[model samples]
Target chain A: MNFPSKLIEDAVNEISRLPGIGKKTALRLALHLLKQKESVSESLSQAILKMRTEVKYCAVCHNISDAEICGICASNKRDRSIICVVEEIPDVLAIENTAQYNGLYHVLGGVISPMHGVGPDELKIASLMKRIEEADAGVKEVILALPATMEGDTTSFYVTRLLSARGVKVSTIARGIPIGGELEYTDEVTLGRSILTRVNYSAE
Target chain B: MNFPSKLIEDAVNEISRLPGIGKKTALRLALHLLKQKESVSESLSQAILKMRTEVKYCAVCHNISDAEICGICASNKRDRSIICVVEEIPDVLAIENTAQYNGLYHVLGGVISPMHGVGPDELKIASLMKRIEEADAGVKEVILALPATMEGDTTSFYVTRLLSARGVKVSTIARGIPIGGELEYTDEVTLGRSILTRVNYSAE
Candidate 1:
């Protein structure tokens, strides 16, 4: 598209470089920002610059943090004996938002995917082992909270083998039909797995 | 959602302030930026700040520009006898992309919307009149390229009435079925107008 101004063109180009945003969307955003007060763009740019330049990663869990250790890893109230292993930082946020898990998180960065040239060595697998093996940390169980894809399963199995040999119980989150899912529309593999892992009737 | 870091939270909040972006999408964008090189974020922020702070508007048509007069208005190659009136800057860009018209453009900033407290005085209608009234510009025709909405029509009628009194011909873009649109699914009003204003067939 022919941009009226070089500044707008530059802004739109930079914005469209972001994942999921296209040139049209970037142009829309640039126009919206132009219509808003100068302070709005000022704050937005300042926030992004500050976040990118000053953002820290948790030394223990590799999660984005403001300090050397993340809040979850530093908190005494959380279940320190169990670590919920996730494939990325967003997954940690997703699980945290659920409010179902009280344990700390270990961000693996990514799962093993040979197609993508990503192996166990490319992820934070070594750091996870180091955390679990720490004498005073007392980590007992390692929960694999990766996706349901083959890469996720492979990473889960790989982590499980390593943790099992290190004398820690290894488990994965249950695979089942979603809460509001209908049996008729449920995919075959998920339905089959849910049936195979059916639990005894226990009123909670 | 619980953000892992305050920096991420602030960046997400600022980003979500943009039109059509939500909290989750903002988080996703922020995380994507975090994963990319720090220089990427730096360039993005720099571009946004530069665009917002240094952007200029055309003195003649009120379109976004780098100089006092926009490239379109400054170009002698463009047809000087006719001007296409549009609702916003993006409309000018859209028409330019079509490459169908060689006339100049006058962006009205927005249409007259009483509900939104917008009126003709809020638009660049006066400047448009002044441009036509100029002795040497020789502008003879004003094309209403506004949307088919009530506000757009109202603004069109108002502008046409003013330009008509000045002895300048006023016309509107044809209302018709879209080029790829099927007649079976065409809306009644557009179809009705398309049939009413049918043009004579030309072999070419």
Candidate 2:
């Protein structure tokens, strides 16, 4: 589309570079910004630039943080013995929102995907092994909370194999029909897994 | 959702304020930006801020431009005797893309919408009238090329009533079934309009 101004064209081009945003949507967003107060645009630009320039990653867990070590890893309240392994910072946030897990996290940054040229060495897997080997840390069990995709499975398998030799218990999150899912609508693979992994019910 | 860092939280909050973007989508976009090169984020921020600060509007038609007079309004190739009135700058681009209409434009900025607290005074209606009255411009006709919505119709009606007293020819774009639209699937109002406004077939 022909833009009346080079500035608008530049803004639209930059905005359309974002994932899921097309040229039309970018134009709409640029016009909306034009109609809004100057402070709105200023704040948005400042926030984005500041976040990009000053963002930090936790040295221990590899999760995004403002300090050397993340809050979860540094906190005494969280259980250091059980570490939940995740693919990214957002996964850590998703698990934290449940408020069910009190253990620290080990963010692998991403799962093993050969298609994307991401290998085991590219992730934080080596650091995870080092953390587990530290006898003073007292890490006993590692929960594989990564996605259920093939890449996730490959990463989990590789991590578990390495941990088995080090005498650390490695477990994966249960895969089955969701809590509120209907059995008839559940896929065959998940339904079959749910039955095979069934456990005895107890009132206690 | 809980973010690991204050910077990420602030960026997410600001980004989510944009139209059609929710908290979850904003989080995803923010994380995507974090993973990209720093120059990408810097350029996006710089473009948006610069556009907002330095963007200019055309002096004659109020369309967005980099200079006082827009290219369309200042061009000698465009028809000066005919003006197509539109709701916004996008409409101008849409018509221009067709490569059919060569007339100049008068951008109303927006339609008359009392629901949104926008009225005739808020738009560029008065300036349009002044342009029509200017003897040197030689404007002989005005086309109402607004949307088919109620607000668009209301604004067109108001403008037509004001222009009728000045003895200038007034016309509106035809409302009918769109090209490639099926007769069975077309809406009743549009189909009826199409039939009512049908022209005599002449083998040219």
Candidate 3:
């Protein structure tokens, strides 16, 4: 309402559309951008643009990447025998920051939230199963690092049942992470501890 | 170390550069962008790019605009005779949000801060003085709407001395605003009250 400029107003509005960024915070961020040198703002804008234009989902692991395979999937140092499954790319970053895990990762895109209309058909579960069954026989484990939500638990159970049918070692990352704690907020020490304490999941 | 893609890493790193956005939060925002439809991220990115590319400062009032003069300076409905000086464009927005003030504004760009090496020359003080001294004779009241910080007080005193010597009615928004409070953070009611009870400067 009667903002300083149309461009600024539009910019603030667009930023406010971002999750967790309100109008007041958007205004503060926009003003901060306006105050910086033109090059800084220009670079920031370009980086955001590049993220949309260049990044894509790694076809193999469903992780975000600029190519067919994500860096984690491409890395020779990581143990291909173990694949840590998570709900999103940020979960990959959370695990990576720990500097303790030397295993590969697979992003599930999302958990099975029937309430949100998300089912196995919409997820990358089929591809995950195929990858595990088809990988060279060195594959030893498939770790479910999904959030400890009900939906995450349901998805993990279904995956374990399916993967176990193929005789692959199935495990869920430890429940040491708080029941409601988001992977994005957990610190490296706690996350590493949880990873180290992974538990086995067997079909009842 | 082994971030998925250069573009994704660059975007996350750029976002992390913002105040209070840590590496984890940056990664979270980047992942959110990746999750959105391509068009949504592209549009938001383009909006930021356009803001940096097309937005410019109003030569007359120092507020950001797409043209040479800001809307407040060009609007015939606004009282150009009364110039309300503020530290930033957000301050102008704060005042305008009330819809009670009819006066135009002058943005100082920043207040005087010795610790930050910001002084009179760093701000738009000279341009403001030129507008007052050489503009139409209708120009009368010059209200200082600066923050209540030590730097804000110093800047106000400095600007008041400069304008007072030129035989103009120089005033400052009252001290009702809590000390050390920023204009951007104050409520409209408090700011309006401060404006209504502005104190006139006199020779000691």
Q: Which candidate is the best by DockQ?
A: 1
Query: Interface RMSD for every prediction, one decimal?
Result: 0.7, 0.7, 1.9
From the highest DockQ down, the ranking of the candidates is: 1, 2, 3
Q: List residue ranges in candidate 1 displaced over 4 A.
A: A202-204, B202-204
Q: Model 2, range B30-82, lDDT digits (tens) per residue?
A: 99999999999999999999999999899998889888999898899989999
List, residue by residue over B1-204, the lDDT tens digit for candidate 1.
888899999999999999999999999999899889999999999999999999999998899999999999899899989999999999999999999999999999999999999988999999999889983958878899999999999999999999989999999999999999999999999999999999989954
lDDT: worst 10-residue window of model 2 chain B: B195-204
Note each model's CA RMSD in angstroms: 1.4, 1.4, 6.8
Off by over 4 Å in 3: A177-204, B177-204
Per-residue lDDT tens digits for candidate 1, residues A20-112, read 999999999999999999999999999999999999999999999999999998898998999999999989988998999999899999999
Return the TM-score for each candidate structure. 0.97, 0.97, 0.82
Residues A49-105, candidate 3, lDDT per residue (tens digit)? Answer: 888878778888988777888877887888899989999877887788888789988
DockQ for each candidate? Answer: 0.92, 0.90, 0.54
